[model samples]
Target: MSFDIPDDRQYLESHEWALETDGVVRVGITDFAQDELGDVVFVELPGEGDHLKQEDDLGVIESIKAVSDLYAPVSGEVTAVNEALFDAPELVNEDPFGEGWMLEIDADDTAELEALLTAEAYEDQIA
Candidate 1:
């Protein structure tokens, strides 16, 4: 099996992906994660301005097969939430990296991203 692991972002062993740009980090689940979960039915996410610690519970993603907890890959204040998911959760299955992005956070420490896995390493992990 193969998965889409973009080199532009960092990944957690738990399957969250984080892409940082100008101090803000966008987060979402990986394609492999969505695939394993089956079709996403709903997503529960933190509101804007919510503060989160690294590894904190970010939210829940419900799929036909299972419910999964999403974790914060970096500590920070949530800057935005993808409201679109509430209406069309299937976006997670169609575009895990783009329109399916869960949230964006103003990271407390951008350097923290360095601790995450690279695309190559993440690919190896799911392999």
Candidate 2:
């Protein structure tokens, strides 16, 4: 199946994606990732106000296939976590980039977003 790699976002080799808007960085697993993981069963996310560094483990995503780490794409304080996922983790598979977003961070440096891989680069990696 083809995956959606949005041009507006940045991605990591490990399959996390980040989108920067209004100085906030929103993070989630890529479509390729959720597909590979099978059905999501649980999510462990950081609380709001938690601090993180670039590449730090921000949370865990558990699936029938495996349990994977969710990393921070940029250093910052977490402004929000998708608390809804705690109740309905299947959303991670259903709408990963939208209502399924894992967290929003107030980025420490906007330039970090530029250092990330483009959607094409990410697609190449997964391909």
Top candidate, metric lDDT: 1
Please state the error at residue 56 of candidate 1 in Å: 0.6
Question: What TM-score, computed on C-alpha atoms, does each candidate reach?
Answer: 0.98, 0.98
Q: Ten-residue segment with the worst summed lDDT in candidate 2?
A: 108-117
Global CA lDDT computed for model 1? 0.96
In model 2, which runs have C-alpha deviations exceeding 4 angstroms?
A: none
Model 1 lDDT per residue over 1-127, tens place: 7788899999999999999999999999999999999999999999999999989999999999999999999999999999999999999999999999999999999999999999999999998
Candidate 1 minimal-lDDT segment of 10 residues: 1-10
> For residues 1-127, could you state the per-residue lDDT of candidate 2 as single tens digits?
6998889999988899999999899999988999999999999999999999999998899999899988899999999989999999999899988888999999999898887899999988988
lDDT of each: 0.96, 0.92
> Model 1 Cα displacement at 1 (Å)?
1.9
Clash pairs (backbone) in predicted model 1: none
Any residue pairs clashing in model 2, and if so which?
A: none
